[model samples]
Target: MTSSLPLLLLALCSLSAAEAQLTVFNLRASDLPSGIVVTTDGYVKVFCGSASLGETSVRNNDPNPWWEEKFTYFQGQENDVLRLEVHDSDIFFNDLLGVCQRQINFMREHDCFLESGGLLHYSYTLNGNNQ
Candidate 1:
């Protein structure tokens, strides 16, 4: 609506114009709960706010699975929170394994977050978040 233009402008004005990039290097899980008959097929998905960055391929049969996949997201803001979810892929329904979340601006150059059932390893170049 026309009434929202000024507010939008204000919000945009508050945002830093410099570029930023976040790189998720990999994710790994250990001791994932296995179904009675089968081992877990685990995967991971990442999000910046409500926007999905990408997901990893399922690694089958191993509770200690490492996905050395990389994902890059650009133009991050100060308030953006990075979220990662671990899941067990199943035939009927996927099970939620764990979740990790942290503010993008508060992260170090290289850090790991201990999720409920896993760990997310990531790094970011947050030159723009200084504003």
Candidate 2:
């Protein structure tokens, strides 16, 4: 019985470790444009577009318009890579703002957004380390 207990504990520990290592990739965007391919490693490469400016142009009046901020998330598994891209849409700024608002509301509802926290901080966490 004592030996069986040790084995059971070991099994439980292994199970917990597996669960802890299971990571999920989530991409929330208001719109996903066509002809966009997402890789496993999170590198967003634009294959084709109407204009070759690297990103969507916000101001058509300007000859040299600025590119919209492109957001992506990726995970690697040995030689395999998984990536997701949230391309900037025509109304990207507004969409991003809406996402931020929703996040703030969620944090507030969970009591995680404390007054002392001072203007909700957001940073990326990659490979078990905060970036």
Every candidate's lDDT: 0.73, 0.24
Off by over 4 Å in 2: 20-84, 88-131
Give each model's clash number. 0, 6
Top candidate when judged by lDDT against the true structure: 1
Worst 10 residues of 1 by lDDT: 109-118
* Residue 40 CA displacement from its true place in model 1, Å: 1.0
Top candidate on TM-score is: 1
For each candidate, C-alpha RMSD in Å?
A: 6.8, 15.2
Residue 129, model 2: lDDT of 20
Measure candidate 2: CA RMSD: 15.2
